[model samples]
Target: MEVSRSMKDIQWLRHRVGQFLCVGFDGLTVPSHVNDLLTTHHVGNIILFSRNVSTTEQLIQLNQELQTIAKQGGQELPLTISADQENGVVRRLPADIPGLPGNMALGATGNAQWALKSGQLTAQLLRHVGINFNLAPVLDVNNNAKNPVIGVRSFADTPDMVADFGEKFIQGLQSQGVIACGKHFPGHGDTTVDSHLQLPTINHGRPRLERVELVPFRRAIEAGVDALMTAHVVFPAIEPKPIAATLSRRVLTDLLRQELGFNGLIITDCLEMNAVANTVGVGRGAVMALQAGADMVLVSHRLDRQLDALASIVQAVETGELSQDRIDDAYQRVANLKKARLTSNRRVRPWAQLIEETRTLQHDLAEHAVTKLRWESPLPPSVRRVAVLVDERVPVMVAAGDNHSPVLLADALQAVRPDLHSTVFRFPETLQQVRTDDLLAQLRQYDFVLIGINGGENKDYLEFVHQVHAQSILNVTLLLRSPYDAHLVPQSTNLLALYENTPWMAEAAVAAMFGGTADGALPVRIP
Candidate 1:
């Protein structure tokens, strides 16, 4: 029943408990605190974000130094370096990294082959940078149009299509030796709230859950997925009382482990998230997650919180509050996963070659994902002047954990029309009354106007679009973020849905607007 050797052989089980804690720090290199966590606290895993990465060479060095620190700390196994490189809108890598058309775009293509290629390319890029695990291929079926977090992250609205793409993606990841994890298990797609801000609850009964939420997870497991990350949203249908799935025994152990038959590692979402932190404190929540059946507890963000969570778990085991058998089970799974996936032979491919390959794949996928909602007519041949307008504030959701970057919409359009005039309106404050009038007056002189819409909430921007249409100018509205906004806008002619605001998506959309082909269909419903 015991995994490896008995407790008598090891000097201290406290170090073994540290393996369960995966922490994040804020820098391009390992800070003093993170180094202590690895050397003294014996933490064995790390999660990287945009703040921790700059260039490919720098990131590779950081990861290598991380492994060296773990080994010097007397740890026996190679550290598991993980990231949220989901490639679409949630990408954590630098701008130069391939920002593939994400999930919904791939779903729009309706070709599983693209999903397979996406997974392979993503794995190649991650492994090249020393990342051994990818928190990607979002299996959540985005059926809710108002879902703030998972709109373009999910593959499709239906379970079968999600499963088909998810399975292919898993195969692609595992083929390249990087572990793929299907995330926000039991579905975070049906809710309107972002779990990073507060917890949301799903009321769907068991049958509906089995049909929709659990389908992709089941398929991922069958495809030999190495891990699954838990969602913090409450599912009252499964658990008697209100509890987030991350800390619910019925959800993590009874349902995910027993009923679903998933033997892979079960990892919790960040304990620092408000969904867990606001309810049951981070340290206490970490203890509860392990006891409830999670193989690894993520306390991504604060060093103090990570140490506290690790200390809490050790105390729970020592005080008999958490059984040693549970600790052993979780540790064994983590160790087995490392042994199977982590290798010393991981070679970093040439940065330029990897970038070229990934961009090539992204360009092809973007062409297939750009959907032309409506295209009435092309611009008149005699047009001498054109105006391009885009929002200055791109909506970077809290859930996105985005390090702000420039949107290339105007740049992409300017490449085609060298004489095009571009405007970037500021958000919240709205364009000043004088500035708005000046912009509209300028729009009247241009032969064509191009407007960018981000989720369609800006009333002032919408009003400006209407004024331009009223002037009878040839204009095209670009749906930059949400696909549902295609119906919400008053003027619906020549609307292009790009779903995401990434640079690659922007270029593909601009190409489609000017005589280029965009054959993608809508994967989700507007109504």
Candidate 2:
């Protein structure tokens, strides 16, 4: 079929190609560069990070401004605004927003309904803020205990458990009008490396990949998931080369689209990650991602990189490096999704009512997720001198999305013990520092001690726990992050796993510490 090459047709094709690019920018409001991307460059979608979010009103206003800009830019469809509101620590919302304890927390409860409810509540929260697309419900089966990034973000270690929770979560989001995307297909749960820092390889054979890693993603597709995000890691079983899955035709197109039968929007992970950028470059990575069958190529930060991606896509089509049919197919998918979800009349719920409802849900979920592993030691009585130590390291995994100081556990402990002395120390891996003798010497004066561990993989953190046990003082340890740390702690220690460091999880841990109820179980086995 011969296509027209007139100026009007070329402009239309440019607009269509731009729709395949989901870009991000700094700040809460629409910046001048981003405005140029939408108005002049015809970029049609955006992804919001913590930097672009603040209060509820501010977020709504900002989204409204983005839509206004898109409309004024001569685009016919409403822009699909997205955020990583994954309901746990990975969420992009502010601290005040009511949140769940995250996927592993929900998995601890062993009730798939909570996953569904969390998804529904998350959808309500996003829809109320004028955000329609939610990049969430991580379906990765976290089988590897040493996984550096996916730890508590995943639902469970087993494929069936992850699939059960993931299917319901997807149902929750799509039913409530927000698009839920199952991420990092075929899976990122077994990796020891962070894709943001470097590209990792999954060397599993085809049978192993189908049996373990591909289970949740297969279920997600069967459950009618709205979209699937490609991983940046290399899968040699699916794609022979060392190329990441995001730029692999066999992985993204043959396996995910053909074999798995997923026909929804296929979005690439941020092309700016070292996995893609350091290797093929973001511009070329974007072109390769599209050619590999990704419906949308995301360049999440840096306007220059985004522009580079846009130009690369245009040039690929102009030079016949990319087929016109392929570009049109991707555009049609994006347009179809926009018409179905974005064109609807979306009315934000009443603010007071929404807040109260979400808070109630959050509290219930936290209570259900706080697991009491074992309490060999007696609970602390009314002791005057008490020392509280917490891992003050920012999350080593960038996907954890925690950039601020962690004070939730400290604040919660302080509320209970008015005279409690708290100490915050950096992780050994974070600053190449360890727990000091001076800190332990100060703890010797206290009759009882409470320790919070977030960096369980760090040798220094585990060593500190061993040291605290040597003191023979009564103590309790809370695994504030991944519960896998429970194995690293002393066997005789009283331990609790909260799976996340949110305020709700902190309060639940404190309640359990003070002889309150924490009946949750471990979602993953400690090996």
**Model number with the top lDDT:** 2
TM-score of 2: 0.93
Per-residue lDDT for 11-66 in model 1, tens only? 26778888888889999998999888898777888999888989878998999999
Q: In angstroms, how far off is 29's CA in candidate 2? A: 1.6
List TM-scores for all candidates, in order: 0.94, 0.93
Candidate 2, residues 1-527, lDDT tens digits: the string is 23555766668767888899999988978899988889887898899988988888899899999999989999899899998888777888766677777899999999999989888888988888888999988989898888888889999999999999999999999988998899988899999988998999989899998899999999999899989999999999889999999999998889888998999999998999999999999999999999999999998999888889988888899899999889888999999998988888766678789889888888788888899888887675666655666566545669766543456666877765667666654445433543367667767877677777776445666677687787776888888777887766855368899898777888888878877768788889988
Total backbone clashes of candidate 1, pairs 3 or more residues apart or in separate chains? 0
lDDT of each: 0.83, 0.85
Model 2 C-alpha lDDT versus the unseen true structure: 0.85
Q: Residue 297's C-alpha lDDT in candidate 1?
A: 92
| Candidate 2 residue spans exceeding 4 A from truth | 1-5, 393-395, 403-406, 416-444, 456-462
Clashing pairs in 1: none
